[model samples]
Target: METSWEEILEEVSKQIPPKYFTNFIAPLHFVRWEGNQMVVSAPSQIIKSHVEAKYANFLENAAYQIKGDSFRLVLLTDKEESTSHMKDAIENRFQNSEPELNSEYNFETYIVSDCNRLAFTAAKSICEHPGKYNPLYLFGPVGVGKTHLLHAIGNEIKKKDPWKTIRYVDSISFLNEFIFTVRQNNRDSLESFKMRYQSYNVLLFDDIQFLNGGAEKTQEEFFALFNFLYERKRQIVIASDRPSYELPLHDRLKSRFVHGLQADVKEHDLSLRKELLRSYTIQYNIPISEETLEWLAQNCDGDSRALIGIVNDLVLYKKAYQFFLLSDEKIREIANSRLQTNRKRIGFNPDQVIDLVCEKLNVARKDILGKSRKVDFILPRHLCMLLLHEILGLPKAQIGRIFSAQHTTVIHGITKIKEKFSEDKNLFDLYQSIKHQISFQ
Candidate 1:
């Protein structure tokens, strides 16, 4: 008797581990459903061998037990591996479900760095095994790879487990949705959102630090959501500019985040930057030089998106109508210009500086300018005062007046900054730039 395709799938799935079904068969391609036989395509020959060697008997026995021993499982690769249909499906689904995550932000395109490498590997780990890492947290500076990592993980998880439901959104977006859900106050809407979170095999929230208004209510709700999914062994991942502790999070909320595996993404180091530039060069079909890449890497710092932007600008700057021409000097100039422009743009006032320096250096603005001489706030406090004094060239007394301290206090700040200048060249450069930015006269 000829077995139907539906029967063939039903019997096969029953024999395979229910948990592994999504992990294994979802990646397997249902290439063609011809009469009596099903042509499946594995991702690679290795996958084909594993299925055949390990699971083939189970599959064959399933066919015989359910319907008949007539259906054959032919694992093909040539046609289905082309990725045209899969790519379209992924792109279309993204367009519908998560439009903000750019379709281009896939694992193939992400740049791995020491800062983000552990986090990258962890995300990949969870993608491979959904329940292993609960509430994956990754934090770093702006323009870092946090969002890229989230997108890459989403795309990869989708590819690895096509049958599994996945949800990825930024924390701010989630916050807005959460607020609306609260406003609606409908049991069904709330339940539906909760179900979506709980039922999703993988859930990723970007910029989780945005949860950081330290608002008791929002944090409470999110904490519940995180706990609920975490308990079920479902995957929960988040990305933020900084870790939970670094931000002013409530103690309860803070404990939930740090309890999970968290990694700080490193700034873009030289080698990773080179790899990133090379990838962009290929994407734009341009031929960039090693020298240019080195220069860009040295100057562009840790932001890969910024590097890509530099590449696009280089393409336009080249102005070659026929084809993309990558030049060494052009890439360098673009990178340097961007770095300088960005560095030159960080703005603040005396009050803002005092507030920030006080917090970062863990000192009070008053003590910073006061005669406390307490080394605790002394270094950073003095550093800020020195920056103001040197850059603004404010009279010691006038600058002291702003911080409500003696003119001698301002003088002391300037002296400390100079003393630390050689030991911390980068710090000095930063002070000079800050001075430059605030220079009105």
Candidate 2:
């Protein structure tokens, strides 16, 4: 008997989670088979690319399993173009396009918590009523879902009104493109570039902080674009590593950024972290016990990206070793190893260094900042000063303000710690241990 397409899909569905299947695979229609190739129809180019990248292998294997014969796979859009034509279609679509919005980063996949609820709500509001905020500015630290929300807004708007045009571009790309156009030194080239940006109904700009240093022309162009879109009441969304007020752009540009709504995303709390872990486990189809999930959530102390990374590592381990059940001990080992390998040593701030020193030395923060001259208080205080200066590269004057001391006092404290480190082996070991903890954190 010949195997039907339904049977092949059934086999493939067994391996993919239901949500993923519904989103990526259920929309696909099996077109007619041509010779030894199975042609499938995807609803859109985005869906076609995702399915081809992630599920093409599983789909091909499923067909082989059901039919007992090898066959090639070909995915086409609803247009049902031939393979040769599909290449041309894709090239044309991307010929002058900005970065495509990721289909996978819609609101449904974003884990909302108190930390990001405001930003999420604001983004949703913009979709429902475009240009209400004019420019919905989202600011947060790295890995805190700012970029995700930016893409989410664009995806939501595009979904609701397919006719609406949207463009997503980062500051660096915007700058590079402007420089390329300027080198042409042609009046028409610059005008064409301006028209391309102004044509979009919605513009999603990311990492606006990158525009801070020495991109005067790009900043001017962006300023003009901002005025053009705002005056026309077109929706614009922006994201950055810091708040708009902190951005070092021209006064006019900074004033424009503050003209609209500004939403901030904070780091995930413990409950939020656990929820994120659970969501990722489900998304990746990893079987993790509640206890293991809790432990991993508590131990991994960064943003959602770090937690998801740990779960992804576990998925790789499971596939590599074929481990049906992962022991808690094994999971911890994997989490620790992955954390060390991917840890960013310079990601800490002065406040974090101070807190770590106080925690390790059992010294009160008040005493560290106070005029305490006791041996115990003095040592911890000096350690904080040294770490802040050496590790963070903070100026001595800035360190003085943090410790409520003069610059000379700050310099003396740091020098004292260095001398202690050279003379005392135990103090050196303690410093190393604290530094290690900071890196892993």
lDDT of each: 0.68, 0.84
lDDT accuracy of residue 420 in candidate 1: 86
* Total backbone collisions for each predicted model: 3, 0
Model 1 residue 180 CA deviation in Å: 1.6
Model 2: what TM-score?
Answer: 0.61
Which ranges in model 2 have alpha carbons more than 4 Å from their true place?
Answer: 1-95, 340-441
Error of 1 at 425 (Å): 22
Best by TM-score: 2
lDDT of 1 by residue, 1-441 (tens): 134445655676877787666666546656665576666777777778778777766665666666655667776664555654665564354335654446688776777766568878887787777777677888877876887888787788788778877787777767766666676568986776677667777778877767776556777878888888788887888787776776666777778776567877765656777788888878876686777666565555446777778777767766754445645665666667765555433355567666656665566667776667666766777777776544433334456667677644555566667768868888777666555545542
Worst 10 residues of 1 by lDDT: 388-397
Give the poorly placed runs of model 1, Cα more than 4 Å off: 1-103, 320-327, 330-340, 343-441
